[model samples]
Target: MSLRVTFLGTGGAVPTTERAPSAIFVNREGDRLLFDCGEGTQREMMRAGTGFGIDHLFVSHLHGDHVLGIPGLVQTLGFNDRTDPLRVHCPPGTGDDLHDLVHAVGHQPGFPVRIEEVGPGDVALSADGYEVRAFETTHRTVSQGYVLEEADRPGRFDRPRAEELGVPVGPAFGRLHSGESVELEDGTVVESDQVVGPPRPGRKLVYTADTRPRERTVEVAEDADLLVHDATFADDMADRAR
Candidate 1:
C-alpha cells in the first residue's frame, strides 16, 4: 500500500502570497482525504494535481482559515460534474454551522453533502484497512485533532522455513501467510505461526490544527509517522501562544 501526504496550504490565520491557509491532502492506497479546507484550497489542489476525487473532509475547527474554502470546493466539485457524495467530518455541535457553510451561496451542489459531528475519543471515519480517530486539543473554541491509523498487518512470511517443513510453494503458502493452518498431502497440519512472524504495526499520522501545546497531543502523537500541529507563533511569543 502506498501512503503519501501533500501540504496543499500551510499559512497562518492571515494568508500571504507565499502561502495559502491550512489544508492537507493525504493519499493512502489511493483513498484521498482532506484534513482542512482553507481559502484557495481548491487552487492549491489543482496546482498540486491532487484531483477532486476526495470523498472525505476532516475539519479541526470552524475558523475561517481552517474551513472557509468548503463552499468554493463544493462548487468546484459540482462544476466538475461530481456525482459522488461528500462526507465532512467536524467537531461536535458544529455540524449545522458547517452545513450552512457548504450552502453559503444559498444553493446546494448537485452531489450529496453530509456533515458528521465527531467528538474527542470518537471514531471520525472508518475505512477498509484503517480508522480516523478524534482527540481533544487545547483551542479557543470547540476544536479537536485527528489520527489516521491503519490496521495491524500480518507478519512476514517465512518461505525457507515453510519449504523446510514440507510445505509446498502453492496455495498453502498463501493460506499460512494469512494466518490459516494448512494440511499437507500427507495429513500433516502446518500452523501459520510456524512460518509467520509476529504481527507488525501499521502507519499512523496525526493532525492538530490551531491548538496550543498540550500533553494530550503528545500522548496521541506517540509513535506517529507524521505529526502536523499548529506552530504559527514564534518561540519569543510562547507566553502569548499559550
Candidate 2:
C-alpha cells in the first residue's frame, strides 16, 4: 500500500482567505487519518474529494482555530448518517476541551465518539494495521506531534527456488518461510533463508502542526515520504512565531 499526504491548512492561529489553520490529511491505503482539524478542515476535505466519516483525528493543541471545527465536523458526519466510530488523540487537556465544546454544542451523546489523551509515548490503536506514536513538541501548550504507520506486509516468496530443489508445497512451506528447516517427503530439508526476501518496511507519515523549528522535528521526519510542517510566517518572522 502507498501513503499520500494532503495539506488542508497551513496558516497560523488566524484563518485567512488564502490560508486556513494547521490541518493535514494522511491517506494510508484508503483510510483518512486527519491531523489537526483546524477551521474549514471539513470543507477542505470536501473540496479535496475526501468523503466524510473520519475515524481518526489527531490534534496538537487546544487553540481555537486548531480545534474549533472539531465538534462541527463530527456533527456533520453524524448528520450524514455516518456511524463509524471516531477516535481522537490529543494532549492532556484535550479531553476536557472536547467535552466542554460538545456540551456547548448540545451533543446528544448518541454519536460514536472516543477521546483519548496521549503523551510522549507509543499509542497502540489496533493490531490490524494502524498505529500512532505521540511525541512532545515545544509549543505554548502541552503540544504533541504524531507518527501514523501501517503494519503487516506480505512480500514475495520464491516458490520456484523451492520447486527447483524438489521441495513439496505444504505446511512445511509455511514453516520454511518462517525461518525454520522443514523436512520434505524424501528426507530433503528446506531452509527459510533460501526462499524468502527481507521483510518490507511499513509506510510512515509525520505531521508537525505548529512549532518553532526544533531538531526533534527533523529527526522525526527523517526519510519520511511526507513531512507536513507549518510555515505560518516567512523566515523573517522566526522570532514572532517562536
Candidate 3:
C-alpha cells in the first residue's frame, strides 16, 4: 500500500530559479509514472533525487513548458541501457507528432518508446492494482488530465467469526484478512468471506496539468486524496488563460 507523488516542476511557460515547469512523479507500489515532462525536467528529477527509470510519461499538451523534456529523458534512458519500452501518453490527435518528437533526437533509443494519444474517459494505463483515467480540460489548445486510482482492498477481518470457527488468532487471521481460506488445527475450514467483509475503499489522486478552472476538473477530482491544480496566474490574469 504505497503511493508517492512528487511535483518536479510547478511553474508555467517561463521556469524560474524556484519552480521548474509542469512535471509530476508518481510511484505507486514501484510503478514509476511521470506526468508532463517540462523543460529541464530530467535535471529537476536528478536534483530532487527521483529515479530515472520511469515506465510511463503522460503529456497534457504540446506546450513547450509541458513537453520540452522528451528528447533528453529518452536519451538519458538510452544511455543508462534501459531495455523496457517507455510508454508516452498524450491528448487526442497528437500520437504522430509525439512519435516524430521522440525520434527527432537523431538515433533510435535502446528501448522502445510507445506513444499513445488519448481523450476523455480513456484508460491511459491499467495494471493489476491501479488504473489511470484521462479527462478533458479547457485550455487554449487541447489538453487532458489524469486520475490515479487504486483497487479496493479487502475489508476488516472478522475476528469473532474466525475464533467462533476455531481458527487461531495469529497467522491464520492474517491469511483470512488477505482473502485466503484457512484451516484450523481441528481441520475446520474457514472461508475468507466468513472472516472478512466487503472490499473497502481505495485512494485517488488527480493531476490537472494546466487549464482554466473548469467543471471537468471538479467532476474528475471529487473526493480525491490529493488534487494538484494549475495556479499559473492571479484572478486579474484569468482572461489570458482562456
Candidate 4:
C-alpha cells in the first residue's frame, strides 16, 4: 500500500507566502482524505496537483481558520462532475455551520453532501483497509482529533506456488491469497498455508488540530508513522493554553 501526505497549508491563524493555512491532504493508497481545510486550501491543492479526488473531509472544529476552504473544495468537486457522495466529519452540534458551507457554492452539488458531527470514541469512517477514529482533544473551542488506523493485512500470497499447483488466476486466486482453502478442478485440496503468509501491521497517521497537549493524544499517537499537530504557542505559553 502506498500512502502520501502533502501539507497544503502549515500556518496557524494567519497566511503568508511561505504557508497558506491549516490543511493536510493525505493519499492513502489512492483514497484521498483532507484534514482541516483552512482558507485558500483549494488553491494550495491545485498547486500541489492534488486533484478533486477527495471523497472525505475531516474537520477538527468549526473555527473559521480551521474550515474556511470547504466551499471551494465542494464547488470544485461539483464542477468536475463528482457524483459520489462527499462526507464531512466535524464536532457535534455544528449542523448550522455545515449547512451554510453546503449552500455557499451558489448551486447545490450534483452529489449528496453528508455531514456528520463526530466526537470522542466515535468511528467516523471504517473501511476494509483503514478506520478513522476520533479522540477527545482540548482547545479554545470544542474540538476532536483524528487517528488513521490501518487494518492488519493478510499474510503474503504465494503466487508462484499457486500457479504451480494448477490453480487458475483471478477470483479463486484472490480467495486463496486471503487464506481461503480452494479445491482445484483435479479434486486436489489446496490449503491456505500453501499460499498465505502471516499477519502484517499497517501504518498509522494522527492529526490533532489546535489543542493543548493531553494524554489522550499521546495514547492515540503512540508509535504513529506520521503525526501532524498544532503547536500554536511556544513552551512559555503552555500555562496559558491550559
Taken over the whole model, the C-alpha lDDT of each candidate is: 0.94, 0.76, 0.88, 0.88
- Best of the candidates, lDDT: 1
Worst ten in a row by lDDT for model 3 = 98-107
Clashing pairs in 3: none
Off by over 4 Å in 2: 124-126, 150-155, 158-191
Candidate 4, poorest ten consecutive residues by summed lDDT: 101-110
Candidate 4 Cα outliers beyond 4 Å, as residue runs? 105-107, 158-173, 182-190, 236-242
Best by TM-score: 1
Query: What's the count of clashing pairs in each model shown?
Result: 0, 0, 0, 0
Q: Mind sharing the TM-score for model 4?
A: 0.86
lDDT of 1 at 111: 94
lDDT of 3: 0.88
Q: Please provide, for model 1 over 1-242, each residue's C-alpha lDDT reduced to its tens digit, 9 standing for 90 to 100.
A: 78899999999897899999999999999989999999999999999999989989999999999999999999999999999999999999999999899999796799999899999999988998899999988788999999999999999999999999999899999999999999999999999999999999999999999888889999999999999999989899988776
Q: What would the C-alpha RMSD of candidate 4 be, to one decimal place?
A: 2.7
TM-score of each: 0.93, 0.81, 0.89, 0.86
lDDT (10s digit) by residue, model 3, range 129-203: 889999989888999899998889789887887888888779888988988888777777889999799998889
For candidate 3, what is the TM-score?
Answer: 0.89
What would the per-residue lDDT of candidate 4 be over residues 1-242, giving only the tens digit for each residue?
88899999889888888998899999888898999899999999889999878878999988888888888778888899888998889888886788798789465878899998888999999976999989889987889899999998888888998899888898988888777889988899898888888888888999999888889899999989999998888898868666
Indicate the TM-score of model 1.
0.93
RMSD of each: 1.7, 3.2, 2.5, 2.7
Q: After superposition, how far is residue 23 of candidate 4 from its true place, in Å?
A: 1.0
- The Cα error of candidate 3 at residue 197, in Å, is 6.1
Candidate 1 Cα errors over 4 Å, as ranges? 163-166
